[model samples]
Target chain A: MGINTFNIEEQGFLTTKLSEFIRWAQRNSLWPMPLGISCCAIEMMAFAAPKYDVARFGSEFLRFSPRQSDLLIVAGTVTYKMARVVRKIYDQMPDPKWVIAMGVCTSTGGMYRSYAVVQGIDQFLPVDVYVSGCPPRPENLINGLLKIQELIKKGVPPKRDPIFI
Target chain B: MEEKIDKIVESLGRRNIEAEIRQDPLGTEMILNVGPQHPATHGVLRLVLKLDGEYIVDAVPELGYLHRGKEKIAENMTFLEFLPHTDRMDYLAPLSNNTAYMLAVEKLFGIEAPKRAQYIRVILNELSRISSHLVWLGTFAMDVGALTVFMWCFREREKILSIFDIVTGVRFTTSYARIGGVAQDITDEGIHAIKEFIDNFPKELEQCEKLLNKNRIFIERTDGIGMITKEQAIDIGLSGPNLRASGVPRDLRKDEPYLVYNELDFDIPVYEEGDCLARYYVRLDEMKESVKIVRQCIEKLPSGPVKADEPKATLPKKEKVYTKMEELIHDFILTNFGGTPPVGEVYHAVENPKGELGFYIVSDGTGYPWRLKVRSPSFTNIQELKVRGKGNRRDDMVGRRGSIDTVMGEADK
Candidate 1:
């Protein structure tokens, strides 16, 4: 059986009829907005290239003007001033959006704990998946995408908004 | 009360929000501010655009958002300690940044990176070029409304980052490239992963080419956009793909021949269109060339110590430092970071992912440089935006901006 099928089988022990199709769709297509910051942004680029082919899952669409995007992949460090802009971008996206906090910088600010960095983007935005690595490999991003699909299927819509405005 | 507050907020130093409605001299066009903070502007650069409604008449780029006094920082930190900070300059290619700065210091001390270290640096630098090109391709696509390409590119990039992690134990801001040689040696797993990645990437390239390389939309959005003559490109001091696309065959790796780049075999892809499409094609072709270089670096990988065997110039081995008292003290000093360099001036330049990243260091015989200057590629590449942004539609400007692949962090730094 395919990995997705096996995953469904393993988790299907107590499956909900309502989430089955949603689970399948979410797993297959997790469109991500590439919120590139720095060098990690380039690695994020590599992940999207032919060798890794993120499109196989159906989320290859990296929407820029966030209105159409459903996923925000933070791929670099969020500096002090840039933090506000990141929040604004996340807010601009439509509902049902997922934030895959790619790389340690966006996950926990990585090794740069300087005064200029915001530590982790999650402090200001609700992160759905935190992909670790000083700068994560394309494999990590792929795995993170799958994990986010799992999270989406879990169907727990947490009500924690990082900003009130 | 809210309306008044909103008006106050809107008027309060809020520059470059929108060009649709802004004040300028009569007969002047709509002024599009490309950035104060933008994706392709490369760092915190701001552009004052004068558009005749939609056709830009003039463009002026305002810079200095990342002016954190880098030269001043160099003055404060020891020579080796300052290497990591240099990594932030052209961040998309930190290894190149690291190498150029390290080479500057090494030149001052008159030492060479070990053969093994040189080989690894060559591999990483070429990989950095490929990574940088992917970002350029993805974002350039996003700017043109081809969002799908971005995700596809990121998927492939993930593998490269993993390879980097295996070698350096860190990614993004890798201080892997250090003075005298690389700080850490590449492990066996790292080499295998890289080999697999290289072998598998060609098909991915084909997929991407199928997706957009010749798509009608991709052609329509980028073709003839951001047009520049070869003479204009040269006059502007444009380097890297921007220059190559304009029919200039200038590559620091070929011209300057630093590191093992001289020993490596690869092709430099060039084009003569001098437009958005040309630039895009150049970078895509460059990615293929970089892959060629990566493979060559792997095939000829030599065996030796990764760092210069010199004491005082290179850090002592970690194993010895742990056991030997004298070595331990040296290690402590290297980590603690505050030793002076012998006074002199040296400039080191590298063919970075963007373009030429040059470091000009003036040392007053101290660890800190008395005066430090970085010749950044993004900053130079961004300069061309002024020339291209003119006479373009509002929507078209973004696409034109994307072709340049400007990284604000490097530009501003």
Candidate 2:
């Protein structure tokens, strides 16, 4: 620390920053769509409640249209028959959108594994974050948001892939 | 050609279905069938939307896609065996279904569950409520196009599921609630986990609100869309948060306190808007109340045997049932064929996270129940879509569903 301080005094303190710009953008604006499918969505609502005020993250904008959103979070199971539509929605999302595979079902097809279920949606669309659990705690989702922020900040929009419509 | 078009138009007009002069004037409006497999509709719901351009002029919701004939299936099973299937009705809020059906059976048995079990059921049911609402908010956002909230909502939901897993050894589809009471007692670690979750869950919700609650786009899309007025919602038999959103204060839990609800302090959050936003708002606030209920249950949780002392009706404890001969025989009989109930019928309801989930069971003094019918919330809740979604846009279906929060597993069955 002393050496760094001395070096900062000497060399004006060079810093290694990862995803700084994208992080700033994410911190200022994080839009999430309510992708509730089953029971997990209730906890999702609690995450946005006053006590759990999701607004503290400055990312409370849950866009209703794919064009306006930068994030695609699949909070519940993505059954086989629904995969085509999920893929289509992912396809419809404009560029610079992030996909969060929420819940064990969306991340890994959960226990609803019949002949149906696409497992993880990452096979169809690029998933930036995978929140584990039948449904994860809201804090885990917050952590996920931060991690995605880091990814977004480090991510160059052009380099990071969005489904090219 | 014009005369033929006029004749076709004349015939179409008689059907009371709107036809417009889009590019395909001779052809009817574009038909897009949504669901049977959709993320936003909550289950395998199929909506036939007749659209003029992108505007939805007519919508028809098709149910029974996920129908496993639950009512018929229920008739084949014994009273005790039917508990697990109840859990599947509102899969998102299985605890509520489990509790409601158990309460009905308890009514038939003419026995009150121990205080501890009541509190546990309340705690679990509320937790289920929290989970269900989380899902509704997350996917409603996705259906309307916001995606990040889905992840945000699920993150906190994991804690509740972990709690359920801890208490019952099952997560989403839990059949933990038994005939007389819950199968097991909650551990200290489970309580601690719940405390930790309850303590920390709010901040995460705050983070989510930062992302959504007040975005202009979200407001515009949801503000006045999919309106279900108080009268309309009541006429349609909506329950749970959906009914509360329509400015009606109807909740089976609150109006008719059963189990541990009499001891807990909570209120039904209501909104007069009755639009998507009001529904969303009511559910959002209810989550806070749920956390409060869980905290209360945690604070007031009693120490006692989890199950009731009904030898003929209740399953023996694992320790005795597995080790002792008499207990073993009892267990074997219970497993092989559940006990018979006297000829009687009971209909029980609970405020499942989705809505009011009720089970009507008729016993015939045999090992199997004569009839079992589920008055599923999702089934009734889904009917609102047809009304709430009339004259809406194509992409707006997700928003309408986001408001109602239907589950096909329960609805179709």
Candidate 3:
């Protein structure tokens, strides 16, 4: 019999709701692979620091390895050259992954309208949430993380092409 | 290749050593690519380290990964429009970069900010220096596994960021400075907040020092790992705290003395040790000295107009332009035509947190700079890594973290 078809009622072991438990566990402890590139990276670091205390939300476990991480915080200017690296890191990350584009540069090319900078990273990779600012304040970063938690709790919506104006 | 090897072997024969027989020529050295995405490499710095069994044989750093072609972009944009772009060059001390670029443009226009503006610039620049060093300290300490110091340093840095947020609109990349003067005048509330930060920061610094100053692991990890001699430092053009740690008492604030720095009485700390620990100590002491300078600037701040009264060169405040007809027309002309600086090339260097951040601008009597070249300190400072990393073991790489503090943004720019 398939595991889904095998009734827990027949076994009578008193199990918790699998999807709810998975969502709760994933939402609470989202391991972030901090892909810090520039100015936004500093703000991201500040968010992880003592005063902001990213640990309070249990996302403080910044796993450098992509395989261990669920959330990718791309915090800085993503130039055309660095986009390949960003994509490689994203591809390496195990499935059910989320991306938080943590600056205007990542969401859409902020001020850098030149040949070197990638206009927006979303052309290649799917961005889940975008925290906008030249470099957003640590408080804004926290709110973005909370929003991600909310998304995880009530399943992430189907991927949509983000509008860049 | 065989002939060259034979010649080397023949030369070594007189010394009773065969060059070819020393080791098999077929043995390939292992190449380790250490980033473009490492936590310890600071920000997107890739080092291709060639190793012979844990000993770094040669290290070749790959640049241009973060290159945004800032100089080329500056050529297209108006001089005033380029002010915000300067913030990204050395993102750590954006105010310092902004000040340096503004001073360059001011020189080109043959104008100077009033005494009050000068004092405000000095205070803000010093605060930027302190904040930049705090980031270096936090990252460097974290690389060495001293997590407490990172937290302690960031706590102090958060206060500085909030201060910047109050004074300037943004927190991190604050494009606060303009050509003739600063974008906004420092209000009484901003001054009060800075004073409070200046008062409380020293105690916080002391706490940070207590955590890492004489801690056994901290010292062991940092102390003598990367030693740059006085001659080597001078030869390679190392500046800022990195140069000072090697016993060179060359500080731009003391040497150049731009913007009320001459009136300030502060001692430059120099250490003769020329090691990673000495560099760390030099930055620590410099932060205290920066506090002293900021205190002096605040006390002696003269009251006057922040922006220079040059309508052709400077745009009027939004409130003035909206309410007044003459100001609106003047703003329109200024924005559309832009300021025409004389056809001259001027290079202005500032003591950035990293090192001597110099901007070389060649103006062709147009609104846009003809040629803009940046002499970023991290560009030269990072070159010393190859020299320092040569003798150090692969494991010693982490220990040598505090020696060379390079922000790849400035380095690549």
Candidate 4:
């Protein structure tokens, strides 16, 4: 009744294109594979916690299994050693998955311009939305999630560039 | 008999049973890799567990998945520039990290924060401790299969973060503490919020405790599990609640009073059981103790300049920097080069929510520290996993590890 916007009682049936229906379904229920690597992970948890209540956006189900999740929230610093593991997890996730680079750390390496931290996760994985903040507040992260939802609704595929090692 | 024995041996060898029997009489050892990304390890901590059937034979905790080279980065940057980096170390209690690092640097410069500033620091430290313990309680309970407790704990934690927001202007990583003092003074609204939170938080904590404190499943799962002796705890260098839970009444706050801790009257909660449950009780009691401290700090809060009057060691006020020429020059120099401490080393430790967070700074009479070493408690406390995991069931590792409350950022750093 809310997002569906249909009067099935009058028509006695509901009709929609299969692709639109799939997109709608995918847009909702965007189960996040929480790659909570560091401080940003705390904010990511807060997003799921009661105050933020990510449930309203249908992203409350934080799937630990990459195979099942449709969204990957890279929530913290992805170091060089951890990059391989992150890429492996990204690869394991099924097609039509979107990634939300959940902090400045994940988005552009943030304040840590050290030898260990990876510059940005976009080099290794396709990022759908980049949330800015050292560790973005939960609301900021929610805004990022909403942007990802918008992309899904518009039927824009997650952009992927050829990874340079 | 010899012919029969030879035939049995020959048959065993033909089936390859003889080789297996000769290699090991009992074959029950299995290797279990816990994390690096697993939720229970609490951020990028991986444990290699050697298990004999259901029981763990040994555990090897592999660190450094989240090491951003904070100490090395500290050496390169000025003292003031490195403040924010401390926030990421113990991400749960960023305020405590900020306070500890600032205290260390202030010691290096031989300048103490004003009375009001010290009281404010104490209040912030306790608030962060409660928040940190709340997260630990929620996640630890969640690990023990009490999912509702996690929700309830976070609900209370959000209130604390709101208080943090009011006072520090940021929710999570508030680098509020500076080299000689705090970033700014606390507002009336912030004081009001702290008072309100202190009054109401214990009731919410009681509710969370009601959910798990006497619950049979929670008790059975944690009561005698992952036991550590007092001697073992001390030997392994466990500080904070972990050491206190093991019957050692050693707390850096009590033993070596830092900041305004000596002025405040608070009890260090101790439990002799040294199990996961005792650790839980100790933390629960500590949150109550923190509330008491906060109340006392609010009552005894002195009205004076929040930042120290040391011009060389402390940053100039924004108003002074804009209006006065000397202050302007001082601000420029401080921002560009930072304050230069004497050519010496100072080691300062604070009783963080996790444990004893010590910072050792070596000054080459320069703005930047020659070498900065962080003695993070989680790193020392995590060594107990090897000791605790032995003889415990493989599944019990989750509750056991969670009880210790090791934040990998601090541990790996």
Candidate 5:
């Protein structure tokens, strides 16, 4: 069923706020395509593994395919060469998708302020939650995921003029 | 490289393969991009596979997706300031990276770390090796469809990380080693924790071996796959377990014997077969050897200062810096300018978890190095992919996963 095709009047008045219900459901099942590029990717995997368990927040099934996922976790240092590939993957994902910049490197280039590294991935893709650490702790990554869920639940307006071609 | 690709094409031609579709109308030669995003390539490594039906005609590995110009960054920062950057190189094995860089600088300065500090470095480096091998085992098994082994391996790895947290203060990016010695001394509790892990890890390894070692599917998938001769492995400059798997036994620890390794008694594991199974076995045996080394280190653990008293080479303690005037000046000089080694060059190599992780530093009597070149094992090991990928089927790429263990952090550095 299409997300927009749901009818409120045909269903009932008991479930009056259908949009809230849709938003609630949408926030819970955020499938992330972990764009694991460097050191931060290891911590992201730790978050998915038994200890941190990102699945507890309903974001554990790491979709390598961009089409199947809505949450994009860019988890490492993004280089200038990789920026093109990142943008291409971002464009490939369907509308109503969120991006989480999962480390200091992806958020602000961290320690690597070089010609090769892209300053920040937000310049290339719209970032929802920016987890700041050299490579953030799995707990911090989980907290960032929670913040993204909160934004989804509150129904923030979709970004316009986000991402480089 | 173009000549090698053409040679591979020629070899394919001799096996009734046509170079162009125009020459043979029914030819099925196709170029497939395996990833910069795909899961099986491990971390962002893109392989362009030239295929004819199911067989791989030739494969080209495309890197620099994760290149952060670590060496270039090294030229900008001081030798001490750059220690943290090495932690990101082989992110799985930070201790080994730290020791390798530290040894190179120590050599340049014509100084040696104290016996206690050397033993501590050995313990930490070997622990790092075990943790790295744990990750390799988990990911390699996961790639081969052994799902249960991945979870099992991580379960064991978490215990090691906790042990690291006690001594190093951080789990993943542990910038623990300094120019002269480690950041802090290992406590009695830390020693006990290491002993505890050493005692417990072997039993866990036994369980893992039961799950994987004799498994028919594992043997069938990996036994004869990705075969490399001793000459090919040596010519391609493979080191660590990958070289040892081909029966070379060219471990830097045994050959060069740095960081009190000559004092420690441990055997280097070697295998006659240079297949995927042999590589896997070599790592498993190495982990046991690492445990042996750690146990010996703890037994001969010296009680003394971890950091050297050299005012020029190392940072002074916070108490000394705050209280004493001479200490204050030393601290200022150390932090602002860093250590100034002699006007010379030195190359220090260590048997890292991956392979031979070496640092070549050119010091121009400055705090910052004139040039720092890293001879990363993953960078050299990935070349074997070109040699092994030839004549193998497209699907057999998974079997020839010696290069998949290469971290882009180290490989592209």
Candidate 6:
């Protein structure tokens, strides 16, 4: 059940599923843990800046602390050394958290197919959305955030089973 | 952990700080790890600070968290292929990095970019300087508790990025500069946007300056904090505005006069007081200088070909390649095998937004460089933290590091 009827002047009550209410709350307020590692981080900052204004989607609060955030926006190249730190941060974030791989470098290692860079972050952490660009534009990042919101609204659980290191 | 502490102590002994550590009344020297992930460190730069109560006893900057084996990759790829990778190094000022790398390759090839290309390069380089400094100013202001300045800086920065979009077709990683010239000519729209940005930029810059330049809290936080003497700055090899802040007038644009810098009239903003505020002021003044330089370049903009007439070193035009058989063959060879420079070595440095970004390439008369060493300014600039961070209050550490402004990608590379 959702909002069935409404009256401005009269005392009225509306009923909705508890899950629906929770999902709506969760979808609207996905506090991001910005893992701004490189070039994409600039674009990520732009997403949060006055121009793109991620605050409109209710995801403006960029929690540097993983424990306080529900969304992990890994916004650059993830090297092998940094992968451990990334995984640790991902583990620290509470349940129902989603990951947005915000650039080509984080997605399939992009052009940096070196020994140092991790081929893809999905090898260690469960990434929900992949925004593809050498460094994705602010609009592209916003589109990725919207997709994450859509996923939350649909109640799709994040795939937590990462490939064992 | 025990060995690490011992090593630190031994290093401190060399620096003559062992007596102070040994004579401490309260054995409360705690180690603080600032990041490989924290926000203020600015892109995976980790600082391991040894703290005595509220004061930092020593600061050791542990780098390489963002090292993508850039030099190693450069060894494998052709000169043209490696240009895009340069964008990721100093991610904030990609155009400067692009121009720096291209200049190095051009030196090896013994060919200069055309006058038009030189002017365009200068314009882009100065624009990137403004953008990079804006990011640094925003993030640095955030480090010192001035949140409003960050938003204001980014608002101005967005205008610059839109201009980048018009010129280079990419906003963030504009790998626009080619070996002999830029990828394309600056359009009429691009010129118009730049002119508009330069005209309106100063007022926006002044608004930001008003917020932080005289605000009591901002002054209290930055003034007399992270003081590095002129000698210390020189000894530590601090470059860019950081060195200039310490009263060293070693600007590459002024001293070396690369591209059309000699043609343009701009001042080097140097400060004798090498504190955090001095660094801030130098950068602020430098941004205005950058605006002036861009305006001059626009006024002195040439109409000739942007690309140099070097068939062996530069790529053929796409239209010409498609139309003519000879040009198509040249394109195929250039794209696949890349330009072959004579067996030699060349080191070229540009006044990047951060500092002197120098590339040393040793070629074996092949399509690729035998050895490529990136003399990234951040790597050298970060060393001052180890020297200057001692005895400062722990809270001031963020401001100190921000004032220096090291990007991890360049540092680690």
The DockQ scores of all candidates, in the order shown, are 0.20, 0.08, 0.66, 0.80, 0.73, 0.85
For model 3, the superposed segments whose C-alpha errors exceed 4 Å read A1-16, A157-165, B1-28
Docking tier of model 2: it is: incorrect
lDDT of 1 by residue, B114-211 (tens): 88888898889878778778766777787777877776776666667678778887766788876688877788899999999999987897798898
Output the worst ten-in-a-row residue range by lDDT, candidate 3 chain A.
A156-165
* Arranged by DockQ, best first: 6, 4, 5, 3, 1, 2
Q: Estimated TM-score per prediction?
A: 0.75, 0.70, 0.91, 0.94, 0.93, 0.95
Q: Clash number for model 4?
A: 0
Model 5 chain A TM-score equals: 0.87
Q: Please, what are the lDDT tens digits per residue for candidate 2 over residues B200-236?
A: 9888888878878778888888998888888998999
> How high is the TM-score of chain A in model 3?
0.85
Task: Report the error of model 1 at residue B75, Å.
Answer: 3.0
Strongest candidate by DockQ: 6
**Candidate 5 regions with alpha-carbon error over 4 angstroms:** A1-16, A162-165, B1-27, B402-404
| TM-score of chain A, every prediction, order shown | 0.83, 0.78, 0.85, 0.92, 0.87, 0.92
As a whole number from 0 to 100, the lDDT of residue B259 in candidate 4 is: 86
Q: Note the clash tally of each candidate.
A: 35, 78, 0, 0, 0, 0
Local lDDT at B17 for model 1? 37
**Where does candidate 5 chain B have its weakest 10-residue lDDT segment?**
B13-22
**CA lDDT, candidate 4, residue B153:** 88
Ranking by TM-score: 6, 4, 5, 3, 1, 2
lDDT score, candidate 1, position B147: 72
Residue A131 error for model 3, in Å? Answer: 1.9
Candidate 5 residue-wise lDDT at A10: 70
Residue lDDT tens for model 5, B46-132: 887778888887777878898899899999988889999999999988888999999988888877788899999999999999999
| Predicted model with the maximum lDDT | 6
